[model samples]
Target: MTRYLYKELHLAASPISWWFLAGALMTLLPGYPILVGSFFICFGVFQSFQHARESNDVLYSVLLPVKKRDYVTAKYLYTVFMQMIGWVLCAVLTVLRMTALSGLMPYVGNALMNPSPLYLGFVLLIFTAFNVLFLGGFFRTAYKFGLPFLRFGIAALLLISIAEVLHHLPGLGFLNTTTGERLGLQFAILGGCALIYALCTLLSLRASQKRFEMLDL
Candidate 1:
């Protein structure tokens, strides 16, 4: 199913990826690592759905021999894979940009590259949360513009609100420190994010399986 999804979705989304890449500065200039991580992820998720709709993918996928459950699994796994890639790529770019403009953006680099799990974990959680919400809506209805848009708006609002609240929290001081300075906090943050990511992934897969099974095509 992974191979099949790569053929059906990501392969087709390749062209659209460039449009997202074109706006890379939107994520970079802000010096927010998660926004950078979200850059590739948002594009991948949106393009997959866009291509799926443009291609009448449901009908084509049904014609294949794969089981519906495997289809859901493949789609979610692919999304998670892309999100991880996005995170790593953004992290690398952040490091490179910091090095290239070390004198100009030392503060920006120091803040982002602080290496506490709080920031990294927050990024992971946001991406994972978006996936669960998006896949739940997308698999159920494919690319129905209304449902996807509505769910996306809701997800965006909630996530942004959480970030805003977190930004003002005193606990963020721990996140400001280097990993060596607060190993226990970093461990907890990473562990919690991983646990939540796993749960959300499983839930999204199950929801997709249930929703897709009920669809006529």
Candidate 2:
């Protein structure tokens, strides 16, 4: 199981994966938002699945000695891992850009230095929501619809929009605040989101197993 999972991760982190990393840096260079990073990551994961299917590797994977549940689990883990890599790279790039711009113009850099806690919170929320929606929806839709790319893309756009709206709620407005005051609140929200993502990932894996079992091949 570990070996198979590593194999999946290796494939996900290959040179092709750099496209996602590059996209993250480009989209986030202007210090726009972290959601952009999540978008690119989700797209990459969806593309990986689509590529696997198109190359007939998915069918070959089924023939391996690995259990259906483990196979599904591996894919879910790979998706999360790849997404995190993209997110971290984006964060680093955002910081670097801010630092560079700040060096050139002190006021601009100073402004970027103190990101609103609300913005941080919103970015974290976007990251979490993307994982849950993309992982859950991607595998399930791929299994059911036989067109993982289109389904994942459509679902991702819808979920991103929903996440954006959620980030704007007045009651949840703490996500836009930057005071060191709400650090605990931010972590708490992130923890809750992480739990939700884990549950959704497990459910997705189970659904994938069931779907694979029912397939004619």
Candidate 3:
């Protein structure tokens, strides 16, 4: 299982794929924050699946002793791995934003720009929805409907993120509030994200297993 996951990660991280991963950096700019990074990571999954199907990577890979479940598991792990990379990038950008753009806090909340436990929950929820559409659709149609579903997820995430920034900006005067209140909020958010992460992880893996079994792959 670990080996297969490593293989998937390496392939996804290689050549044009890495270029695609690097492309996620473009979205880390002001206002956009993690939207593009999230899109890029998830988009990388589509690219990999596309290559696997087109190049017979899946067909060839399955010829090994590995079970279909391992393949499906590897794909999920691959996604989780790529998302870790995205989160790291998000963390770095958060640091840069806090230091370089602290004066701009009145306009955008720190939550919008940084890595927090609360942020992880939303990110996980987003990916959960993305995978629900992608893996569910791909397994049903062999990638035929997957891209459209993923694009929809990406576009929706972008729009929602933008809306979040606009809608919440007025309440961010808390940026200047007492440290205790801010810390309390952060802890509450962290707890929420932790719950979301656990639920989504379990559900995605199980769903992928079921979906993979339905496929001829």
Candidate 4:
């Protein structure tokens, strides 16, 4: 499993990966909930598209004797890994920005420095859920249709629409609220998000297996 993960990480170190890292960095500068959410959504969708493209290559996995199951798992792991890195980057940038402002503007620094646990939980949950849905949908549809671009486009559109709806709904605006009351519900929401993510991943893997069996390669 580790070896398979390393293989995916190697691919992520390519020039294309730098572009994604840069994009993630840019999201931190905006400091707005919607902008940050959009960054994560786009990042996940792009990562899913990359995975689908590589998985469809007949010769790509020829040298590696890893099973299709492991291959898919590796992609999912890689997505999670990248998301973590992105979150850390954002945290570091935010902290630095706050620290810098503390020297000249005490009130601004104090407000930005004390981020609530609920805010952190909300960010993590949203990031995880977006990636799971985007990657799972892309892989399932790409496997079925054998058209990577089409699958990515459709999956991204659907995921983005759902995200937008969720953003506007009441009681779901955890990201904007930082009170202790909201923090108490964070764990429950995270658990539910995790459960849904797991189910989607399983469905995606099953779909991928069925499609792989039908392919001549």
Candidates in order, TM-scores: namely 0.76, 0.69, 0.74, 0.58
Encode model 2's per-residue lDDT on 2-67: one tens digit a residue: 776677755433446557656565433333434555566666666676566566656667677877
Q: Model 3, 104-193: lDDT tens per residue?
A: 754364345443334444555555555666765665555585575656577557744753564256876443232345756756755675
The digit string of per-residue lDDT tens for model 1 on 1-217 reads 5577576555445466444543334334543443444534565566766776677766766667878666667667666766666666655654554455435653453443343345456667767766776677777666564566467556655664565455457766555554355657766987798789888888778888998888766
Estimate the lDDT of model 4.
0.50
Candidate 4, which segments miss by more than 4 Å at Cα?
11-13, 22-31, 34-58, 88-134, 137-175
Give the alpha carbon lDDT tens digit for every residue of 1-217 in model 4: 6776577656532335445655445433333332244354445546544654665543475347867555556666666666666656655654554355324443342312133333334445555445445555545544442354345445545544454355347776653333446656755664565565457656655665565544455
List where candidate 3 sits over 4 angstroms from the true fold: 10-14, 23-28, 31-34, 100-121, 147-155, 158-180
The local distance difference test score of each candidate is 0.61, 0.55, 0.59, 0.50
Span of 10 residues, lowest total lDDT, candidate 3: 172-181
Clashing pairs in 3: none
Best by lDDT: 1
| Candidate 2: residue 164 lDDT (0-100) | 50
Superposed on all Cα atoms, model 2 deviates from the true structure by an RMSD in Å of 4.6
Return the clash pairs for model 1, or none. Answer: none
- Residue 40 in candidate 2 has what lDDT? 68
Considering every candidate listed, which one attains the maximal TM-score? 1
Native-structure RMSD, model 3: 4.1
